[model samples]
Target: MNTPGTLYLIPTVLADDTAAQVLPPQVAERVAALSYFLVENARTARRFIKSVAPQQVIEELSLTVIDKDSTEAQIQAALHPVAAGQDAGVLSEAGCPGIADPGAELARRAHQLGLRVVPLVGPSSLLLALMASGMNGQSFAFHGYLPIERPRRVAALKQLEKQAISQHQTQLFIETPYRNQQLLDDLLATLQPGTRLCVAASLTAPTEYVRTDTIAGWRKQGAPQLHKQPAVFLIGA
Candidate 1:
C-alpha cells in the first residue's frame, strides 16, 4: 500500500462569468479525500471544511494545520507525514494556496525531502485581472505587495508604468486590503492621466466588482471604498 506522504494545494473558482473554474461540491469532495491538511489560516480552513460537510460528522480530522507564520521546522515536521504517504492538503484563507501566496516555501521544502506535492483548483485574482486588463498576458510579472514607503513606492510605480506602456509586457501586482486606497493614491500621483488602471475588487464574492479605465476616470471615482474586502490593483502604461 502506498503511504500518504503526498500533499495537494487546490485553487478556488474565479468569480468571472467566463472563468474556467468551479467550486462547492467539487471542493468539498477534494477536502474530504485529504487525510490531513496544512492551512494558511486554521480558522478559515476549518470554516471552509465545515461549510463543505456541514451534515457529515468527522471523528478526528487532525489536518495538521499551518499558516504563513508557521516556522520552517514546523513546516518540515508537517510535511514528514506527507512525504511518508500521509497526505496533507494545503489551503489559503481564500482562493488557491501557494502561487504568489504562502505554501510555496513549504512546498519547496517538501520537494527537497522527496515528497510529492499536489495543487488543487481555485480562484486567483491575479490571472482574473490579467484576463480582463485587455493587456498582453503573453508575458507578465506579479510584484506581490509593493513598498509602503511613499518615495520608494512612487518611484517603483513610475518605473513599472513606463515599462508596461513602452514594452507592452503587462505588469501585475497587489497590495494589502487596507493599504489599497493609499497605494492607488500614490499610483495616481506618480502616473499620468492617460495611463490605464484596472481594479478588481471582492473577486468571487457577493459584492465583486471590476473596472478598467484611465487614471483620470479613476480619480473622478474618488478612491474605491474597499473598506476591508480583498482586491487586486493592476496598471499599465
Candidate 2:
C-alpha cells in the first residue's frame, strides 16, 4: 500500500500587496514545492502563488476549488492526488486556512483519511487584532459574522456583551466589509457604556488601524469610516 502524502495548510496574506512583509520565507519555499493545491478561489490562489514564487509556472500547477458549496464527494476527489502519495496544499482566500474558512472541512477529511496535515506560519488577521486589542487573549471566542438584520444583530451583540462580562472572556466577531460602519454604529448603541470595544481594520496593510475604547468613548470620538475595508471587532469588559 502507498503511503498518503502530507496535506499542507498554507496561509495567504490578510491584506492586498503585503505578502512580502507578512508571509515568512519558508511559506514560499513550501508553496513552491507543491504542484497540487486546494483553494477557495483558483484565480486569487494562482495570483498569490505567482506573487510569492514568481519563478513557479502557474500553468503547470493544479488548483482545485473547495468552497462553501463543495460537497463531501468533491472534497474527497480534491484530495485524491494527496491520498495517492502526491503532496498537496490548501490555501485560503485570506488569513490562515481552516480558521473561519472552508478549508476546515478539507483538513477534517484529510485527518480521517490518515493523511499527514501540516500548517505553515503566516499572518492571521484575527490573531493580530486580538494581540493588539488588549482584551482577554487567554480565553476568547471568534464569531465569524453577525446577523445582517438590525434587530437580530443588536440582540446578538447584547448576548455577546453579557458573555464577555460574565465569563471574563473576549468576544470577537467580524462583519461584511461594506457593513462595517453599520456594525460599529450598532455596537456603540447596543453595548453598555463601559464595555470595551476594539476595531481593527485593514490589518497588515499600509492603512491598518487598531483602537480599543469604551463604547461611550467611541461614541464621543465618532466612528471611523470603515466602509469596504476588511475589519475585526471585539468586545470585552
Q: lDDT: which candidate is best?
A: 2
- Candidate 2 — worst ten consecutive residues by lDDT sum? 14-23
Minimum summed lDDT over a 10-residue window in model 1 is located at: 13-22
Off by over 4 Å in 2: none
Cα lDDT of model 1 by residue, 9-36, tens digit: 8654434332233464566677777657
| Candidate 1: residue 139 Cα off by (Å) | 1.2
In candidate 1, stretches whose alpha carbon ends up further than 4 angstroms from where it belongs are 1-4, 12-21, 55-59
Candidate 2 C-alpha lDDT tens digits along 6-59? 999999998889888998999999999999999999999999999998989999
- Which structure among the candidates has the greatest TM-score? 2
TM-score of 2: 0.99
